[model samples]
Target: HMTVISAREELVAFYERRGYRRTGVLTPFPYDDERFGLPQRPGLAFELLIKPLV
Candidate 1:
């Protein structure tokens, strides 16, 4: 299991090319948390991706 920023299409495509698929799960970006960095725009989220090793 892995998660990547949904906003990063290139990164998602990279993983997809390597056999990863979206799990349709999303996690909102932590805009309220300074540790995660402040959002300069809205609608940021993480998309869950998964691949079976079998």
Candidate 2:
């Protein structure tokens, strides 16, 4: 399992190419916290991605 910033469509596609699929889980990005990053806009979040093994 991994997380990708929802805004980064390219990354999502990259991961998708690697067999990772969106879990439809959204986590609120830590705004105002440098630990995550400085959000230039509101409503940003981390989207969960998962890859299943055979």
Candidate 3:
């Protein structure tokens, strides 16, 4: 499983078309942590995506 930024719907769709599906799980962006740089906008989150092998 991997995560993509919630705001990037186009990327999500691109993965989905290749067999990846949404996990319906959302993770909050590390706003307090600057190791990942700063967000361009507010309310940024990550949506989990997975490709089941089983």
Candidate 4:
């Protein structure tokens, strides 16, 4: 299983082309949490991606 940000459409597409699929799981960006850093913009979120190696 893998996860990626939906913000990066190109990256998501690249992974999808390589056999990855969206898991429909979305995680909101940590706006309040400073662990990652302050978001430059609002409404930022991450989308979950998955792939099976079997």
Task: Write down the worst ten-residue block by lDDT for model 3.
Answer: 32-41
The per-residue C-alpha lDDT of model 1 at residue 47 equals 99
lDDT for model 1 comes to 0.93
Q: Which stretches of candidate 1 lie over 4 Å from their true place?
A: none
Report the Cα lDDT for residue 32, model 2: 68
Clashes of 3: 0
**Can you write out model 1's per-residue Cα lDDT over 1-54, one digit (the tens) per residue?**
899999999999999999999988999998889998878889999999999898
Instruction: Provide the overall lDDT of each model, using Cα atoms, as 2-decimal numbers.
Output: 0.93, 0.92, 0.93, 0.86
Better lDDT candidate (1, 2): 1
TM value for model 2: 0.88
Model 4: per-residue Cα lDDT over 9-45, one tens digit each: 9999999999899988999887888887877888888
Q: Which parts of model 3 have CA positions greater than 4 angstroms off?
A: none
- Tens-digit per-residue lDDT, 1-54, candidate 3: 899997999999999999999988999999999897988999999999999997
Q: What TM-score, to 2 decimals, does candidate 1 have?
A: 0.88
Ranking according to TM-score, highest score first = 3, 2, 1, 4
Q: Any runs in candidate 2 off by more than 4 Å, and if so which?
A: none
TM-score of each: 0.88, 0.88, 0.89, 0.79
**Index of the highest-TM-score prediction:** 3
- Which prediction has more favorable TM-score, 1 or 3? 3
Clashing pairs in 1: none
